[model samples]
Target chain A: MKNRNIPKKLQDNLITIGIVVVCYILVMILSATGLLSNLLQGLLVPLCAYIILAVSLNLTVGILGELSLGHAGFMCVGAFTSAFFSKCMENTITFAPVRFFLALLIGGLCAALIGFLIGMPVLRLKGDYLAIVTLAFGEIIKNIMNVLFIGRDSHGFHFSMKDSLSLGLEEGGDVIINGAQGITGTPKDSNFTIGVILIVLTLLIVLNLINSRDGRAIMSIRDNLIASESIGIHITKYKLMAFTISAALAGIAGVLYSHNLNSLMATPKNFGYNMSIMILVFVVLGGIGNIRGSVIAAVILTLLPELLRGLNDYRMLIYSIVLIVMMLYNWAPNMIALRKKAANRFGRKKEVA
Target chain B: MALLEVKNLSISFGGLRAVDDFNVSIEKGQLYGLIGPNGAGKTTVFNLLTGVYQPDEGFIHLDGEDITRLKTIEINQAGIARTFQNIRLFKELSVLDNVKVGLHNKYHYSTVEGLLRLPRYFQMEKKMDERAMELLKVFDLDGEADYLASNLPYGKQRKLEIARALATDPKLLLLDEPAAGMNPNETKELMETIRFVRDHFDMTILLIEHDMKLVAGICEELTVLNFGKILTQGKTSDVLHDPEVITAYLGE
Candidate 1:
């Protein structure tokens, strides 16, 4: 791995260093001024949510090789749970930042637990079938929340800005998410700093996992389940592990999403079918099994429709066409030709070395 | 103790009998061969032994313990490892990574260690890498360790598949077709490698090979199967020449 490979090694190291420097510059720009709120609201929040969405979905579509059409459902769980707690705790305690973060983590953990419960039995069904099962799971969760009574009615609590800044588990905060009106008058605490930190931490963890022996086992199972099984892999166990972890990450994203919005809606239709499909499009439109691709794709997709807002409804039609073109490009013989060329170069090196 | 003992084993899909009251035992440290034409229920026997399919009526003893209804992973953890007949390499993974997959059961560190990047994870990971390299060295695949499994020359991919199965440190290695697509020279070399692996691992081997010469040259004992029945059993010389075995297989 060494001795004869210094130049290649240097090139790789420089590329990694370049990425870090770029990320650092971006973070500084976002965090240094009053621009933090704009960054947090406009880009950072959605970026964090999408990264969590893409990475967690990797466990289903990438690791487990199952198609799940209800990832947003898990996000909805994290969002409402975190929102509920954030609302409940406001003004009742001091240093609410720590509690707020804890609430988010708790939301994630709860979502992960639900994922494990759903993944264990339904993972037996794969591909399109698995997707439908997950869709149903999401629907079931949403419906349960839809009819349940958790928070107080609107007439019960009055929320104020000064009181919100002193946010804690207050005896009375506010009840605003009253059937489609949405939770209003919630505190805006999350910033670009937190979003960037989370995105970086997530990338680091996911990259390391992909490079580990266990990660290799997971990827192998994804590629060929039967082949993996014959070699003594516990398919069900690995599938469950991947599914559980993916769900947990999705939960974390949900927390970020709920807190940033400051409103909680337990409505199942909010997450619904399209959200899952959009996330799937993000992962595949980028590249399956490639972390960098997923991240880049998430950022691009999140920004795409927003960037083209001036075009209005026609923008969406053009976006669909672009997507179609991208998928179709995969069919070109030249793309496959390039694949073989890379393969030949590597193969030749094996012979020479 | 015998490596594998299938006593009065039978399985049926509705009414079509897949394996019918088949009984056989493979001894420790012996190279045994199972040879039959297509549809002789040879792969079915493998499935039953490896816990792919549960027998409706039979007892499977590995090292004298009944493993009649164990899950595939439990069976593997109990020291029975196998390679599929069709090449089943993890196509997208690097060659070395593919082999390291078999070492998962042996690596007992917690997932938390990996997530946290603890010092213990580095130690275990290094050890895994070393062992994976060692296996690659044995098969002359160390040079191609980083190449994707699918990118390996076809013959090397097959060998990589076997290396992966061996990574489990099994007491009994079941090879579905260890020499399926080899040139004559490659097949001859494979015979030596088979012998080397058996001796080096100090393990019993049960192989399903279509090539009669390879089976005759390497196997110490042979079981001839026909239409889900044990047609004959003995040394390669005796069994290959048995009147019933020849007629049942060749229609002679």
Candidate 2:
């Protein structure tokens, strides 16, 4: 059984990695052959970013069995912090890629720090209360970012609550952030290759955690908190571990996203309840805890609107219809039976082949 | 010294004493039964002992160490493990993974090692898997190791819960209504399993059971409670036959 488990685990991982590599190669080929339009190529980086967000959000929502609606808040933290860092380094650093990597690290760490602080109190609450608290947190973050102002000069980076001009910077100093205006002039260093790498890295961290001992402890807590505690599992420790890691991965995705845009703002529409809900939609519309399902769902949903531009007025309606049908097909009881039968038939055919 | 000792343990909720002044002591390798009527606070006592509820007034010593104020997981780390009144197996996890969760605390690999798939991680995981399989085999559940725990039959689920608890390698095991909802034959098998666990694992066990036959067949000592207070406690036969115990059982 142990030997069988090894190969099975390896095969599952191989399949996931293989899919990612194939998609990466296909995108590269399309770009090289001039077959992929600039508009479609522009969607690639954001698609990868959304895929990472969906997968990380699934870690907390699906595997951890905790309803969190503040994933966009973590991404917002990462995006703004990393954007600010890149803005500061723009004049100093000649190499865009090096600066981008550092920004990703800083972004992920900033988000993780916030996740740890929030998870400590928020995770203690369960069910709907947890969701509400996280939602409030997301709103709070967005509001704070809206009012935030910072500037950098020879006197060093100055922070002010009033506004960007109130930071009282020296001549030739840059206004890194203006209230409601957000950080501008951020290095647009993110490319399809970088996005793909980040996506693979996100998958690696999340999938690996799902298979580890700590991961088991986390799922056990989700299954039954009392039973988990009886076995000496520290509920808070593992919860925070999953939550913080999920936040960090979302942060990495945010770094990818913000760096791709020349100007990024922490507006309500950009990083508030609607964006959070959109990410949750990706997780749920995906198969909840499934990593590969998340990637597929994110890619399909993100590309669908662009691919169906001919029906511009009805694209969202069509997408909504597809979503409903897919949910019913996946979750309806009779459909589950049919899916199982189809799977068995496919397995049998593969065996014969 | 006794392996587990409880003195003046009490807990209340909303001004009602759920478990009042409960006390017991069990030596190593002992099998003690806690039996009572409905709402008699039998499960509450198990909760207090296992740190699910902090006793308002009491001292609980395990292996001669005071563990009265420890948290649930801390108490478990101190070598105390428990099953639930309702089976609380990791329902979506595989039967093998359910047991492996119990072995989680025993693994020494760091999270970084696990994330990187280091040699130490694989080594420890392989060892834990083999041990988990062995534990399943003991419950005759080796064949169902890969099945979801929720899919198991009632009797097998019960066995798996106990198997999971044992994987914690506890010095004192607590079972809250292990025989609840079982047929007479299933109850009888549980009795044998309870005794087998005590002798085979060399651990002290305290169980709450409503099945009188099971209590009589396996338990050497018994504590009977009524309304959160101890009614009678002594050797199983003596307590089970006590006039007050009979009255309590019959509600006469």
The best candidate by lDDT is 2
Q: On residues A116-220, what C-alpha lDDT tens digit does candidate 2 reach at each position? A: 999999788766877888899899988898988998888898998788778988899988888788888888899989998888888888888888898899999
Query: Model 1: per-residue lDDT, tens digit, A39-95?
Result: 334667767778768877876786557788889888877777776666666666446
Docking class of 2: medium
After TM-score superposition, what is the CA distance of residue B21 in candidate 1 from its true location, in Å? Answer: 2.6
Worst 10 residues of 1 chain B by lDDT: B106-115
Docking class of 1: medium
Model 1 ranges off by over 4 Å: A1-21, A30-41, A139-149, A153-177, A262-270, A331-353
Candidate 1 yields a Cα-based lDDT of: 0.76
- As a whole number from 0 to 100, the lDDT of residue B117 in candidate 1 is 72
